[model samples]
Target: MADTFAAALDDFTRRDWQTLAPDAVDDPVRVAVVGLGWFAREWALPGIDRSAYTEAAVVCGVDPEVTAAVAAERDLVGVAPDELRSGAVAEEYDAVYVATPNATHLEYVEAAAEQGKAVLCEKPVEATLDRAERLVSACDDAGVPLMVGYRMQTDPAVRRLKESVADGALGDVVHVHATMSQTMLGELGTDHDQWRLDPDLSGGCALMDIGVYPLNTTRFVLEADPVAVFGTTRSEHAAFAGVDEHASYRLTFADGVEAMCSVSQTAQHASRLEVTGTEGRAVLDPAFYEREDREFALERGGSRVGVEFEQVHQPAEEFAYFGHQLLAEEPFYPDGEHALGDARALDAVYESAETGSVVRLDG
Candidate 1:
C-alpha cells in the first residue's frame, strides 16, 4: 500500500507546473500598483520586486502625498488615481495591479484596459455581480488580458493537489471540508470603522472577505463550479452589524461533490482544506494563509504519506505567473469569466443565508 501511494505521488510530481520563464525576454513586465493599503504595501509591492518577470514601476492611490512618499521609498513614480483613470502616465507601465477596496475594482481595471495595459485585479472582482460583469466587459472590449489574483492556483501544494484529483489518484472525490478564519478587529487594532465592516465597501463580511478562499480554491481543485449552495450567517459583534461575522455554506457541484465550508472574522486565525475520495483522503493544513508553511498529506487503508515542497512567497509566485503568461501572450486562467462565476456564487451564498433556503446558481 505504501508503495502504491508512492507511485501515485510520483505521478503527481511528474506533471508540468508553472516555472520561471526562460531567458527569452529582455525586459520584465513593469507593473503599476494601485492602492497603498496593507496588502499592497506589504505583499504586492514586495512580491513584484521579488518576481524576476515583473517589477513595480508606479504607485497610485487616492492620497497623492502618501502615494508619492511610498513611490519615493521604492524609487518608483507615484501618481494620483486620476492619472491612472485618465491614462495620463500610461507609458510608464505595461500592466496594472488593482489592490484597492472590493467596490472600486472596475474603474482601475477599465482604466488599464483603455490604455491597452493588462490588468491583475484582486479577487471577488467587484462588490456586486452587475459591476463584475461590467468589469469583465471592459477588458473584453479592450481585448486585453484580465487575470484575477487567485494566488493559490500557483501554490506548489495546491498544484499537486489539483494534479492528484485530476489524475484520479483520489478515486472520485466525494466530499470536501474547508475552514478559514481570522480575528479582524484584533488584526486592525480594535478599529471598528474599517471598510471591511461596511457592506457597500466589502460586499459582505466574513464570507466575502475570507470565504472566497475556500470557495474559489475548491472550484480550482475540482475544476467545476458550484450549481447550488445553502448557507447560514451571523453577526453578533457590533462592528460586524452590517456584515456577517460568521458564515457557513455548503456547495454542491455538478459531479456530486459536496463541500462544507466555514469562515469567520472574529475567530482564531487558521485555515484548512480536506478532500475525501473512495481510495484515499488528502488534507492541506494551513492551506489558505500564505505566510504559514503548508503541509500536505494523503491517507488510505490505515497508511498515510506526506508530500514535501518548499514554501514560497505566494504573491510573488502569482505575480510571476501573470508576467510570464503576459509575456508569452497566452490566455491566463482565472480570467474575468472565472471571477464572475465566483461573484455569482458569493451572491448565492448570501441569498441562501437570508432566505433560509438553498440557492440555485445560474438559474
Candidate 2:
C-alpha cells in the first residue's frame, strides 16, 4: 500500500498494464500499416518502432508511388491497397493498422479480417454509424480481434485517474468537463479542399475529428455510456461550410453523471479534462493533445495533491497495448463493441445538433 496519494499515483503510472496479461507471444507482432498519411508516417511508425511487441513489416497506401517511396525509404515491403485487399501480401504481417480516412476504414478492415489479421482502427471507426457497424461486423465475422485507437485511454495520467475513480477516492463521479481545440487551417496552411471538411469522407468536421477524445475518454474513465445528448454546432468560415468549425455537446449518463464537452477547429491550442465527484475533483490539464506534457491534480475537502509524471509517448503506449493484447490472445478493452457505443454517441451528437433538441440513445 502507498503511504501517500502522490506515491499511489506514481505507482499507478509506473506499473506496466501489459504484463498483467496471462501470456505473451515469443516474437513481436508484424504489422502492415495501411495508410501513408502524415499521421501514419509521423506518429504510427514511431510508435511501432518503440513498441515492444510490434514491428512495421509492410507499408501500404492508396497511392502506389507514395507507398513505394515510403517503404523504400524505411526498407519495408511496399504494397498497394488493391494488393492488400486481394490478399497478395497477407503472409507479410500478422495484423493491420487502419489509419485511413473515416469513410474508407471498412474496406481495409474487411481485407484484414478476411485474411485473419487482427485490426487496429483509428477512432470513430468510420464515417457514419452504419459503416462503423459494418466494420465491426466484418471483424467479428472473420473471428479476428479488433481494437480502436483511443490513445488517451492508455495514457499514464488518465490511467491513474481511472484507478482513483474506481477505488472510490473520488467518491462517485458527478460531472465531467472537457475541452479540446486547435487551429485547423493554420496547421494545414490552407483549407481549400481539406478532407476533414468533407462530410462524406471525414464525417462531421470538428466534432468527429477532435471532439471524440473528450467524449470517449470520459466514457472510459466512468465505465458508463451516455444516455442522451444535447449538442450545437457552428460554421463561420467558408472552409467549414459543409461541416462544423465549432461544436459543444452535453452528455448525460444513466448513473446521473453529466459531461459537458466542447471542441473547435479554429482556436488557440488548448486541452483539458476535469472530473468532479461528491468528495473530490481530479483535473488533467493539457489533456487531449499527445505532444504536450500532462499535469494531474486531485482536490478533496480543503487540500489538493498535485502529481507530475514523466511524459510517455501516447501513440507508442497505445501501439504497445494493442500488440500486447494481440500477442497474449487477450481481448481488447475498446474493442468493436466499444467503438460501436462511441459511434452511437457521435451520431447522437450530430442528430441533436440538427434537431435542436436533446437526443436520447438506446440502452
Candidate 3:
C-alpha cells in the first residue's frame, strides 16, 4: 500500500497537478475536511485536491449550504459540522483535517481520534494548555497520528535554515528575534476582524493569530524549549476592546539563549526571523508567508551571502508530507506533542503579560 501510494504521489509531482484533479490512486489516504473557512477553502482544499496521495473525500462546515457549495465545486461529499462532531462521518475517511476556530479544535480532534482517524489540526492544537494536553492525550490513547498544520516548518528555505542551525553552522546560538504583524483593522469596521478581537474565540489577539509563527519557528530552529518567558501586551486602538492589539514577549531558553518576538494586528505588514550565534547570523525575510520569492541570508566573517527560494507552495508541500507520513506509518513533524510545547509557551506568555512578571516553565 505504501509503495503504491508513493508511486502515485511521484507521478503527480511530475505533472502540473494544479490544473488537474487528483488522480484516483491505489489505497490513497482518504481525508475529511472539518472546516470550509477562508484558509480551509482557499489553501487547504487546493493542496489536498491536487495531491494524488490523498483524496479529499468529504467536507464539513458550520453552514451546510456553504459546505455543499464547496463540495459540489470540488466534487467531494459535503456534510454538516454536527455530523463530524458526532463522529458519524469519521467512518468514511482515514484522517480528518481540523481547520476550525482555535477554541473548537479539541472537540473535532477528539471526535476524529475516537473513531481511530489520524488528525491534522491547525496550530496551537488548542487555545489553552489544558485543552492542548487533552487533545494530545486523546490522540495518543487512540493510537493515531496527530499533526499540527505549521506550514512554514515544511518550507524549503525554512528547512534549510533548520539544517544550518542543527549542523552547527551558527555556533552557540545566543539570541533570536522575530516579528510578524499585519494591518487587519481599517477605518471601516470589518466583521472578520471583529471576531478575532473576541478573546473567547481567538484565545488572545495577534499573539494567538500570527505570533505563533515566530514562537514555533524559533523553537524548531533552536531545537530547545523555553524555560521562562516575560511578556507585555497593549490595546492601542479602541476597536480592540476584548483583546490586545499588539504583544511582545521574550523567551529564555535553558542554554541562556533568549528570543525576542513581537506580533501586532494594527501594524505595517512585516514578517522576519533573525538568529545570531557566536560564529554567524541567519535571517529570513517574509519568513512565514507563502510567496513566490523569499530571501534568506547568512552573515559571517564581515561578509553577507544570501539566496532566494522561489515558487514555494507550502500548503501543498505540507499536505503531501502529511500524506507521506500517514502512508509510511511514521512519526510526523510538529505532531500533537510538538504543538503542546508551543501551546504551553504561549500560555506562559499570557500569564506573564497578565502578571507583569516572568513566568517559569517546569521541566
Candidate 3 on 127-189: residue-level lDDT in tens?
788889999999999898999999888777777777667766677799999998888765223
Candidates sorted by TM-score, descending order? 1, 2, 3
1-363 per-residue lDDT for model 2 (tens digits): 123355448665664566643234457899999988888888899999888888999999888889989899889999888898999988999999999889999999998999999999998799999999999999999999999999998889998888788877778799999999999878656556767888999998899899899999999999889999999999998988889999999999988889999999999889999999988888999898877888898888878888856788888989889988877678889999999998999999999999999999965
**Whole-model Cα lDDT of every candidate shown, in order:** 0.88, 0.88, 0.81
Kindly report which residue pairs in candidate 2 clash with one another: none
Instruction: Give the residue spans of candidate 3 off by over 4 A.
Output: 1-25, 186-194
Better of 2 and 3 by TM-score: 2
Candidate 1 RMSD computed on C-alpha atoms after optimal superposition onto the true structure? 1.8
> Per-residue lDDT tens digits of candidate 1, residues 173-264?
99999999999888756588778888998899888889999999999999999999999999887878879999999999988899999999
Residue 125 of model 1 has an lDDT of 91
Which residue runs of candidate 2 sit more than 4 Å off their true CA positions?
1-8, 20-26, 188-190
Q: Each candidate's TM vs. the true structure? A: 0.96, 0.95, 0.90
Off by over 4 Å in 1: 1-22, 188-190
> Could you tell me how far off, in angstroms, the CA of residue 102 lies in candidate 2 after the best superposition?
0.3
- Roughly what TM-score does model 1 have, to 2 decimal places? 0.96
**Deviation (Å) of 134 in candidate 2:** 0.7
Candidate 3's displacement at residue 96, Å, is 0.4
Q: 152, model 2: CA deviation in Å?
A: 0.9
